[model samples]
Target: MNRRETRDAVVHFGPDADWVREAAAESSAVAAADGVASYDEPEADAGAADAAGARLAVCELSPDAGVEALAAVRDALPTVPVLAVVADADAVDDALAAGAADVLVRRDGVDDTALLARRMEGVAATPAESRLGAESTAQLLDAIDDSFYALDADGAIRRWNDSFSRLTGYEDEELAGMDALELFAGADRERIAGAIETVVETGSATAKAELVARDGETTPVEFTGALVTDADGSPSGIVGIGRSLTERREREARLARLRQAVETIVDRAPLTLFEVEADGTVSTVRGETLPERLGRRVSEGDAAEGVFADQPEMRRHVAAALDGEPAHGLVEVGDSTLEAWLQPALDETGRVTRAVGLALDVTEREERAVMLDQIQASAGEVIWISTPGKESMDFVSDAYEDVWGRAPETLRSDPMSFVEAIHPDDRERVEAALTEQREDPDAYEETYRVVRPDGEVRWVHDQSSGVYEDGELTRIVGIATDITVRRRRERELRLKNRAVETAPVGVAIHETAESAGPITYVNEAFASVTGYDGDAVAGEGLSALAGDDTDSDRLHAVASAVKTGDRGSATLVLYRADGTPFWGRVDVAPVVDGDGEATHAVSFVQDVTESKEHEQEIERHLTEFGEVLAEDLGVPLREARDRLDAATDDDPDADLRRAEESVERAVSLVEDLATVHSFSVEPRRLSESMRGSSPAPAGRDE
Candidate 1:
């Protein structure tokens, strides 16, 4: 090419004057050899670069001036291809962010001017349509949601999107062509530069950085950058997409705060907190000096060597938690004690990532429980706690051993063992009562029988209450009192009552009232007399069976005498079941209590109806016989007597004596019959011995 056809480029010196001079001299020599002219000074107004028709701006930027100064120079000449040169790798980021066309680090055997001139020749040879196509591509990227930017080989921001403006609080007019390093906070500039070199060499980079916004606010962001490549797989530039993580960061901060609050609370409690990783490394997060005992990581060797020497159960709990189930309650830890609550930690996908735990110091509570156990063991009742699902006994007072004739340890190991000890007939009732109580807490007080270890059966009275938490029944606490003696006594009393009710007598023991007269104490004979069962007239007083013709005055007189500590008797016509009248002689006497006071009246009532009838028949016969005898003896009494006396004297007086005896017997029989009728109509002698004991059985004959 001739001098007029040679391509031209511009070389500008920045803060590094020495590097700029050396580069300018070399570029001048190379341009001369290629028949092209290069300048270290600013291009002349309009006519200077028409020979080449295009310009390559090579600027030496000072480390101190950074990408900002380079950006200003690029803005001053908008159509030029700028190539930035740095003496150190630390300046590569600013150079690229400032929109350098290419970057050359200070090194031996590198031809700076020849390199720039040759690169300018290539740009100059490109068609205007290709450059327009590149600009159009950049504009399309500016419409994306994420802040997208392109870095030149010199590590400057060659292109940026409108989203960048929104993220950094900067307008396109203010920051469209700014340097990438200017967007980073002051402290992050060097780190950003290092990352840029890494991306250029490695073809990709990812990091979290704090960037300075237009408003001077520093916001956290995640930056992902990849090396833009040419057709030959050589690095042409870098394209980065930045995601503002302020919201995510804030959420993480809040979560951290919550965790801290939980740790504070848990640490202050009488509990221990732990976190177990998926690999079975347990870390104690809180409680006592656990942080000292259990370091940050629990090694496999340590675990195998019994590293948790003081708490072997912790390993089991961790294993359980890792399996996605919680392990809780008191566990032995060395010589101390712990009440642990364990749960699994989940990742974003809801898969178990680790296990966490909280443990409470239950030493004192255990001691108190032991003391309670001793007291309950000595007590006469059984106390126990049943967990949900009725699977096992959560706790059992020591009285279980004494009451059930089994060891409390055995019962605690298996609550169903105790349930199995219950009598088969009582098992259903006991289970029903428990179910009812669980459903309705107010249902309690169940009675059942349990067979002891010695095979002796005893009745137990159980009262239980359900323990509810979070609207679910968690456990049940119950007290059982033995009622064997009371049950036995009740059985015996029932048998005695049956015997008394079935007695074969109309015997009644009447209670005396001050105002009421003596009550009936009818025996079997009275029931037979009235043709009424004793139960039918048990509560009726003596007057209940009396006939209408009976005298009230006489009955009251007899009752008054009996009430005054004197025995009395009366004969009254008693009504039968068929309403027939019958004569009954009632003897009434006072029955006294231990205090020598009259408690009741005892009356012995006999059915004299047949006896009275027999006597009437006798009297009739006697009257008739006596009248006949009178007629037969119609002769004069003296003559009959003399005749009888002469006949008796002559006949050895035997016949006369026998005749007189016969007459005397006939008169006596008439008199006795009259006396019997009189006695039936009047009161008779009463005696205490004649009192009846109680009521008689049904249908007894008198």
Candidate 2:
């Protein structure tokens, strides 16, 4: 019997006690291993539990013995783990709320005794061994949920709870005696040390820092610390809880960016931002004296309708927006004209929460015919003039025919016919954009697909500015340019980048001359091979990746290729971040522009250590064979040749015959050696790669 197994258990009786009995029976086989003792209901009180060695408390939850029964069991064994068997759904929550350590819903009839034994083993030791009654310090510390750490007076971590261990990615053994300040860095460590000093002077203090983990990952954390006082009233140590501030910091950054964007539009531009309640109350308003220019006297927290009391059209637009649908209108009050766009803000359940809107003043518009009467269109440009509100076209440029593949007469005849050239999917959005531009000309910049008469769709980027004379606005001038080729190039570049990013071999792109310049990009494979993350190496020079001991010849070869605007390759030893060396064949290709001059260079690296070692082994074996061939056969052949050369006229035939036989023997030896080496074996590979967009090596596995 081990200490982890239950020695004593308490079971509380209720009307549905049969469920508890069934569970206990299913687990009785293992429960009997330690000569387990049991105390039924009201008999073994919490005070008597210590003497009885009670380690686990079991109870059945029902209307008869629900919260009240569970509370009594908790009081009897405060620190002991309580396993509650629940028959209905309602009692599960009730048992948990009453401090049950674990609740087992009546599912699958409690068929597995091994699982029950596992849960029992997970509980703490008996109160006499661990704490005064049944109180478990580990459980109490973990109950904090947030990271809990204890630091000594010297700022070294003396103790930490499970939460702190998990959050910091450190094991219990690794955390002991670790400097608490080491978990943070730089200015943060100094600030945290100051905060600890503050805690010693005061009662409590709070500070924030980025908590760096075992693997160098940092988490933004807010820590609250308090001083622990000894009997002499002197500071002994400090204890603190660290709460993660990652989400809060991210949300704050996002909100700050949004506020900056909104302020830029409402403050710098001639626009007013407003939010109103259902009861016609203005809750928010922002702008640069736009309200004053529009003769609006009401401020935020005032009645919204009173802001436009002199203009009934604007008042109706606000009311219509609050009711259900979006509304917009133009109001002419005194000498200025105003355009307002209002829509209801919907909640998660699609309920209308409030009405928000932007108002623009457009009283100084100029006549379009007078502004564009003398301007001429340039190449690839479509300069057009229309009515003050774009109700009809007054003039169209020749470039319109070149880009839209139709004459300008059609648009002049029917101003709305411009929609016919827009792609079907984009026609609605384009129409809405045009309508918005007609209402407020400053909002006219757009990019949309324009379909020609010949069925070729082209992308058009158009921008326009309003023309005004004196104080009355009258015209809108626009320029539309064809951007189909640029769009195609951008899309193709993206696909090429994707192909490069997923290439198998390590790949790096530099500004120019290999790594002589700054490194621009590296894919995941590069990071895997080098053990240096992209963020760590990008924008750094080659010195960051290679040391003085690394091969300079191969690197110089790649640089020479870049200088000559040619592709080149060389074999070299490359080192990972841990200084593990591998034989690498690096191929560098220059990226050229239209002038055929290199603007950038891409380097592809493959580990060739295995294949290079194999080739070396083959060469070594061949060298040994050559030496053996000379020692075993070279003398005999040489003697035969000398005997033939020294033969007299009469005996020359004999010597000649002997030399011929030796020659035949040499021929046989050569043939035999050729046969032995005839079997073809494919060379081993460094890597096998799929067909990629760029140049890459194909190597089979060793």
lDDT winner: 2
Which residue ranges in model 2 land beyond 4 Å of their true spot? 1-377, 469-472, 513-515, 541-549, 563-566, 620-702
Pairs in clash, predicted candidate 2 = 46-76, 364-472, 364-473, 365-472, 365-473, 365-474, 366-473, 366-474, 366-475, 685-700
Model 2 lDDT, full chain set: 0.68
For model 2, residues 165-186, the per-residue Cα lDDT tens digits are: 8889998888889888888889
* Residue 147 C-alpha lDDT in model 2: 78
TM-score of candidate 2 to 2 decimals? 0.37
lDDT (CA) per prediction = 0.63, 0.68
Model 1's alpha-carbon lDDT is 0.63
TM-score of 1: 0.40
